[model samples]
Target: MQTAQRKSLTMLRWMMVASLALPVALFLIAGYVSYGTTYEEADREIRRSLDVVHEHALKVFETIDRSLSEIDEIVRDLTDADIKAREQVLHARLRQLSDALPQLKSAWVFDAHGRPLVNSMLYPAPDMSFLDRDYFDAHVKESVGTFIGATLTPRSPYQGAAFFSISRRRQSDDGSFTGIIQTSVLPDYFEHFYARIGRAPGSYFALRRFDGLVLARFPVTERSAGPAPHDIPAMAADTDRLVTETSPLDAIERRVGYQRLAGYPVYVSAGLDTATIRNRWLGTMSRHLIFGIPATVLLIIFLTLARRRTEHFYVEAARRLEAEDALKHGQRMEALGQLTGGVAHDFNNLLTVIRASADLLRRPNLPDERRQRYIDAISDTVARASKLTSQLLAFARRQTLKPEVFDIGRSVVALRDMTKTLVGSRIEVVTSVPPEPCYVNADAGQFETALINMAVNARDAMAGQGLLSIAVAPASDLPTPVAPHHRPPLGYVAIAVQDTGIGIPQDQFSRIFEPFFTTKTIGHGTGLGLSQVFGFAKQSGGEIGVTSEVGRGATFTLYLPRVAPSHEPRSEAAGHAAPIGGRGMSVLVVEDNIDVGRSATEALAELGYLTTLVDNARDALEELVGGASRFDVVFTDVVMPGMTGLELAEEIRRLDLNIPVVLASGYSHVLAQQGTNGFELLRKPYSIEELSRVLHKVAPVPHHRAPPVAPNSEVR
Candidate 1:
């Protein structure tokens, strides 16, 4: 047993360590994988921001290219040398042409003779010729390139601080050198373009033309100034090497994007400080984390709970295995019980023969001194055998009982006295019996055994040196009806045994009553004591309950039904006249088994009665109806093949009308309904005396109840 327990403990330890380590390792690996993925995603998000800034710079360059193309078309058309056609085209046409392009401030044609043909101003024209001007020379010499002049407020024609341009040698359909045309473009056009690029808050854009002029300054008004604040030459040169980079802006330690406009000689620096961008990202990321964190936490919590449930399943499996083992152990004890009960039954019959034979031997034929010695030996032997039978019945739980109403309080007080000897001097035994009688109808001997068993258990629990308490009172809480045949709210007697000892653990409490279940050393206990108590309580229609704490002590309480009225005890009819010598009354005994039928007939023959025995109920009925067998009483076993004894008894009542029928069986559960006449029942395993007594009680002669008459005085 110790080896088995050590093996169980070792398995449990390995299970516990596995239960703890496995989930921790798995979750740590999972968390590491998740953190790595999140970090990579954060890095990808930074790269995406760089791509957006690069795209914005390309948009700025496209705006400038579109504006330049519009102005070039107007200059090429103005050199047509059709002066009359230009004026007749109306000022509306000229204004429409100028407003058609956002970047070209105003446009007019000045012929090779140096006269203004059209202007995009209020009723005015600029007196200028681009025939020898540097813009004209540059345009004629280059024919396709734009040459932006110096960064100064323009003279005369379309004023308001602009940069002028020229285009010449425009060919008609005949390819003639018509004239040189000049136009001015405003810096506001570039300013408006930068505004469309849309800088971030507290940021700006700068557009630089190829000739080193800061064409526009967003968020700064400097229309009269020539060159802008920052060096445009270096910025424009960096156009090819203008990689978008995040750098600290100004004196403040903040991060922003700086990039040269793609496909053009201009610089666009539009960015927000790192703090501002971080604050915005932080708000968004905080909201994401707020949701993600709880979801992750909930997932972890669910995983932990699942782990706990797995542990519980293993624990439950162990408990079920223990329960199955306990069940097999109890079955073995029950088998032992059947064996002991069979032995006791046969031994009792032998003892009965010995006792009767011994009585018969003590006659006057033997010597007087020898007769006394033989009688003494027989008496001692019989007494010893009686003790042996008592032990057998205790083990088998099949003792004959004379249950009677008794006060449990009286019983507890007596037990307290007995426990003092059992528990020794070091242990204190206390008892509390209620003032009211806690009465139960149970066999006194078995009740004493139950009390002794509980006391012994308490003694063992205390390790020979603590207090044992026995309390007797009315049961407080009882279960409701478990079945239809339950008795009413009759009072119950509670016998509680409590010990200040090594207490039982909560998990092991249910197994304590199982037979052969023990936490004791070998040779110390047979493990039948509590099982006997359990069987006794069940046989007496009672319940047992237990309560315990780990280090504190334990208490077991037995609840038995309070004594109620029932059949009175049968007093032996000691002396009677020869039983009227049995005047040959016919008795029909019906039994299926031959041994039992022959036994009945032989026992009946000893009473000098005529008997007809049959093996089947159908034959018995036929014999009775044939008028050959006039039976005074028909004795039959209740359970038979052809028909039950009750059916045979019913048939006998219908045919013979007044014949008394006796029903006998090993089972008491098959008794007929009470108050049914013409039939009486007898339980099995009866002797001649029991048979004779039941026959006399159930089918007595009619004259047997008559009062005794004086023999001499007669009927007077």
Candidate 2:
């Protein structure tokens, strides 16, 4: 009963652990996946934005290129004096071009000596030296078709602020460079355009020259032109690629995409800040946690409450059942006590009459009539005593069975508790009756007496301490006979008694049920217990059979003709405390030597423990974590292959602290060097008695009916 309860609690523990752990594990994995997804999203967004910026910058640069071509065509074959003759017309043309484009600040026509001839800002051009400007210098050296220059800060009133320049060479008819037509492009134009695209957190846009100089950036920097961010080599080579780098302009890390402006020497960059991406991901996870955590908690709470409620119901049922068993056992023991007392009193009276009559008859020279009467009195007393003895036997359920329709299950269950009182407290008696009633037409008293007889025999075989299991079940027929015997065929209810004790020898099987035959020493046993059981089985039109091994335990089954249920067979329902004497404690035995291992396993079996034997520690652990049986203790050898017994003990504790370890060894350095470490230890060449004693101390007992001080003679 306790074993079942423990198993139930273990199942609940596993459920509780799964409820919390599955969610935690899921969230952890999801966190990693979501973070990566967010990064991918940022990369994609930046890439798309850079495409738009690429088209925008390409269109702006193309406009400047086209305007420069138009100016260059007008001034190409003209000398300085001829171009000065048409200055008004030229100025009006430059002004009209400048008016049409917001990005273009001013357009100018310069002479070969760098004297500005025509200008859009003024009718007469300023006296600026062409030798000083990068656009002018390149055009003069050779007939450069068009050139884009870095930003130039204004040094005169003609230039108001920093501006980039685009210029084309004004060549002669022979294609020699003479002068230049220049356009001043405002950097604020691109900056204002980027501002309209909107700022999202740390997002930014940049336009940089192919020479690694910034033309303009939004979230505008301290200066218009400076070295661009690190990773300029990758930026220059992979024009349409994405990269991650920190912006020197503001020291913000971003996932940036770069696209080179078509037909221009500059690249347009758009980036999504990493800080922004991380913030977005955190929000998503927070929402998930908000929903997930509560659901997990509620699940755990539900399981906990359900387990508690189930335990409460079990406790209440157990208490009621215990109360019923105690009352029933008390009543049976009292009735038997009264019967034994009355029988003994009647036998004493009969003996007194016989002794008195015999003594009178022995008197010498008595009268013949008197002598005859004395002899008759002795004879009558003797006959009466014989009759009284028969009555006693009948009361003890040894004479004749008065068959009646009664529930075999109920009879066994009732007698089972009293049987515990008859067997000593040292032996553990466990009962397993089918929940559905099993009925038969047999003497209820005789059946109970038969059950008690088997239990007493089991107790003696165990030397007072072992497991005695009484199980009742429906059977088709008796088990195959040890030696073939006529057994009533099929359709029987079987009552079985299994004992973990020194088993009977196979050679002695046939003689076990014969009258006056016994395995026990003289005076300790009367030898009629099994014979009586045999008689009862035969008289009731049933059969009794047994199976045994020399060192292991034995099983005896009594099969009776089954009585089909007419109605619900009577039900009676037990402070059957769990025994610490090791009854039903399962043990995992780890020993490498096969012979020694078998001997140890058999010994534990005799000591009333269910055991599993393994030659190595690996197998032992496999049994511990994976096996269906729940072990109460681990009994292992100290020196074995793979993991030592000490190591196995540690591992067992790590897996389940409730199960304890007991180390066994003849002698090993492993044991000598590192003591038992608080574990129980048994040395080699141990006796069966010592093994039983130690296991009784160490095992976690299951709850079952304890044995009584003595088995009543009526049962035997």
Candidate 3:
């Protein structure tokens, strides 16, 4: 569980990190894309406006050229003296052309002498020297197609607004420069048209000569600026281009698109201020951040809260588990204390009896009858000690068992008379058995002992006056709490011992199964009866439960898995078998304890058997397999250091030795779980009669009796 909790917490932490990290990553990507998109849109819009200006400027230049060409054609064959003579007619035609075109301020004709011949405003034009003007001198010096001059404020006729002159050179038929046809073009004409093209604040529009000079501008600023803040691109080429530079008029940075009028020596430019472009980008990002940051923050907050809550949950769970462990530890300690005290008290009582009997027997010249009685008393005390130890082993669930299938209903019914006599004639013993047999597989002796224990406990509860009911019936299964996890829910036979006596209390319910816990006052009950019942039920793949109420009868139910009816255990003969003489047959005794080995060999000799003894299984095997004296049977202890008696038996079986192997053990975990593996078993603390019987059952019968080699025995 702790590992799983760690994994869960680690997952939550990673999610919290991602909750913040992922959105930031997405926002950075979005910002980069939107930044590019904003500038590109401004560039596209600026280029479009410049395209409109380009087309319009081209038409204006072409129209003025056409007008100059027509005037030139009219005076092509006329001489200068002839042109002056017809000045009134030529002036009227010029005035007519000027009045028709709104962009033209006036038109004039100048002679090759750098003198104006006639003008559209005045019939006989003012005698002004044209050589001083770049427009007039440029045609006289070079053979140019058309000359677009720098910006100027015209003399007096239309001098308020700035306009530049568009002039065409007049050539005679011999290709000599005669004069220039000059026209004053209105800059307001282009400015007003450009003003109509929509632009945001700090934007600009302009028409410039091909020589990088500003000719006309919208929202015109004073030309008082210092050096340009950044470099200007060479937009004088025939192709259009985009440039980012400071505006010369305002010293503000702007992105400009320059388009040259097709087939003309003029260019039109449109600009959008960088600040305005950035504002547009900021607006888009502002909208995104307005939603994105809050959402990301909320997600982060949610993850943080989840992390905190998960930490709290695990902390509380750990504390609860710790508390539970402490509780179980305290309970086990309490049970151990009770078990130690009870075991000491019981053993001390048995020892006192044995000591007293031995002391009585040590008197001088004791009577034969009294001596016999003392010896019997000592033997009985020893038996009691052995039984106490057996109960302890049973409570620990380590005692060996001989399990067989038997009808449980008949078994309990047969115990009715004995229970009545034991519980006493005062307490009524009742038996309830189902008509159909309920069979179970368990140790018959333990089952009988458990029943009797419960019966005796009921007698004590009632103080020998209440009814004791013993019932056997078919039980399907036990409660979920009563069943162990490793055991499956199988068909069961339930034996219930109900007593109408002082009932068990609820507070003592859990301790009832603990070793040496009894309700009867101390010195009145030994307190191992119910514990034996608990251990027996568990070892036999079953469960035991109790239900009781104060002042009401209590019921202890033992649930054992039911089995198919089998052959019942037949009664054995009362007489013991005559001791077989083992004069010819030899026995191999394998015991780990030195005292046990000596005692076993001596006992075999008393039983008229020749014996060989060894402390461990290895030497026993050598004696049986390769020793000079061949043995007819093998006896070995089950638990030893290197090789267990069971393993030694199996090895002998593999050797295919015809000798029988008898296994002996007091308590072994292997024996409790897996059983004897089909070998004759002598339980620990066995007497000579029991050992002799087991050996007789497994070993060959000896026919010849011989005098045994013993220092104290008399030969017959």
What TM-score do all the candidates reach, one by one? 0.35, 0.41, 0.52
Ranking by TM-score: 3, 2, 1
Off by over 4 Å in 2: 224-240, 302-716
For the record, the alpha-carbon RMSD of candidate 1 to the native fold, in angstroms, is 44.8
Clashing pairs in 1: 255-274
Error (Å) of candidate 3 at residue 241 is 78
Give the higher-lDDT candidate: 2 or 3. Answer: 3
Task: State which candidate, 2 or 3, has the greater TM-score.
Answer: 3
Alpha-carbon local distance difference test for all models: 0.60, 0.74, 0.79
lDDT per residue for candidate 3 within 1-716, as digits (tens), equals 98999998998889978887877887898999999999999999898887778877887888898988888887777877888899999999999998898888778788887777877878687676767667876888677878888766656433445667888887787788888788888877887787777556766788876666766777665542332121243353444557777765567888888877766777778888899999998899999999998888887879877456757987999999999999999988987888788999999999999899999988999999999999878877776777777777777888898888888888897888889899998888889999988878888878998999999888988888989998888876686544342344457888999999989887989888777888778798888999999889988888888989878879999999987777776434223355555555667778888677778778778767776667787877776677433666788899998989999999999888777899998888989888999998888777676677778778767533333335233211
Per-residue accuracy of model 1 over 1-716 as CA lDDT, tens digit each = 99999998896666556555655564566556655554344334433443554564454334434444553465554443445465545345556766765655666555545456666564444456545455555544334443445444655433465553533344455654444454566666656655665445434444445444555555545455534333234343443222233321223323323355444444444333445444555555556556755655554556556556767987999999999999999999987885565456546765775676587675768777767676656655554455444444444455444467777788778767777998899999889988777768886667888888888898898889998888888853454434432553666777889999989987778778765567877557646667767767776778778888876788988888886544565243323224334445566778888778777777667676566777788988777777533666778898798688878888877775566788877542234222224466665655555566666676676322212212122111
TM-score of 3: 0.52
Displacement of residue 425 (Cα, Å) in model 1 is 13
List ranges where model 1 is wrong by over 4 Å.
Answer: 1-471, 479-487, 497-508, 515-541, 548-555, 563-586, 607-610, 623-632, 646-662, 668-681, 702-716
Cand. 2 TM to true fold = 0.41
Whichever of 1 and 3 has more TM-score, that candidate is 3
| Ten contiguous residues with the weakest lDDT in model 3 | 224-233
Give me the runs in candidate 3 sitting further than 4 Å from their true place. 1-333, 481-490, 568-584, 627-629, 703-716
Number of the top-ranking candidate, with lDDT as the measure: 3
